[model samples]
Target: MKTLLSTIFSLLILAVPFFAQGQQTLLLVGGGQRPQEALKEWVKANPAKEPKVLIITWASANKKQAYETSIQADLREIGVRQFLFSQDITNSFEKNEFVNNLSQATHIFFSGGSQTLIMNILNSDPQLMNQLQHAYWKNNIPVAGTSAGTAVQAELMITGDTKNLEYGLGFLPKTVIDQHFFKRGREDRLRSFMKQAPGNFTGIGVDEDGSILFKRDPKTKEFNSTVLGSKNIMVIGPEINQFRQEKILRPTLLCSQLF
Candidate 1:
């Protein structure tokens, strides 16, 4: 326990130099499927250190040993070595153990499940969240999430219901992310958020087997987003409210493509 705390402290101390580098990269995948291309890109992007991928399954309710074994085997077939799976987390020891693993991680992947469950657990444990932020933003490690995992990355988290979005970890501000968009017919729900939003916020909706890769240009300091996988990625918002009489009009939404 003492050694674990010391390791975390050392990692935080070492991250000071890279703290201002901005977001490293983000791969957000819609629920219902996992795209192999996204995983390949994530592995290829890590030139900082040895490629070590950690999978967090806190959002998942059932703890199946076979699930972990299968995922590990699949990732291995695609050139990913050094794989780790963490689930059913409850105490500081478990959280600290996860933090220790982050020290060597080149990428972190969050599995699909309930967005609310993800937030409730992470929020209650700031220590774990802080370490995540340090590894992602400070240490410049890439991170990916699918389904509910994708939704929790936005500042305003869509609850997959008509109710207002809950506060998220805010990894990506000025954006609201929803998964299984077309598959679950969630376009109407995303529209509701825009209609009621006081300030303009971008809504990113990804369908099953689809994902978006977000990266910052090292030279220009600008962010670029690209679509990946076989399906479409929808981008809405930057809402333009032109009031004609009592009605408001917003620009038509569109989808984009990528190689």
Candidate 2:
């Protein structure tokens, strides 16, 4: 009996690391007013007592400084002191600096602007992309993004003009994410994109002043999303019957769906 109990304890100890690795966290905010509550929730996701945040404003062109200032104010309001910003990839030196910052960050954030521009820059550099992936995936750092930042988290990015589609950072697999969802009247646009999107990808449309926290379960290895803030998050999936005239199906899930 003593040997059997010892073997059970050893097996449980071996499972600890695998279980912790399966849990990944993402905080995606829709464009507009970022509620203090949402930012606080993001802070809580970090395991460190005082997380060092690295804000990447690659999506914004000339407004990078302005975006950083606003986000810095918010972070300070939440009692986050160790925060830094980086943007504008003009030379190899700047790109390398950004990659190095990724390694140091306990939590990484992306600010709002143009998703097209964000992907354009990320796609240009293989090293930068790999490092960002390593920081979030292998290192298990929590990632947060707002607006265009949120849109780039998915594999299929919905450009403001739904007619044109582009590849994103692919952080969220088999999903298409759109921001400023209902405020911009993008329901039809998202549906149209979902209908045309290959492989029956899921569509997540986030309204203004709202956010979704996606947490991957260790036991099931599936993501459970929790809605936060004042607005709604619309999730669209494929219809059960492929032969049906309407291939896209929008479920009745709303803010009530919890993690």
Q: Which candidate number would show the highest TM-score if scored against the true structure?
A: 2
**Clashing residue pairs for model 2:** none
Task: Give the Å shift of residue 37 in candidate 2.
Answer: 1.8
Q: What tens-digit string does per-residue lDDT give for candidate 1 at 200-246?
A: 56677788877777776544544466566666666665545532111
Q: List, residue by residue over 168-229, the lDDT tens digit for candidate 2.
A: 87777667888898898888888777776764467778888777777666556566666666
lDDT of each: 0.66, 0.72
TM-score of 2: 0.84
List residue ranges in candidate 1 displaced over 4 A: 1-19, 63-70, 160-162, 196-198, 242-259
Error of 1 at 213 (Å): 0.6
Model 1 has an lDDT value of 0.66
Residue 259 in candidate 2 has what lDDT?
Answer: 11
Q: Which candidate achieves the best lDDT against the true structure?
A: 2
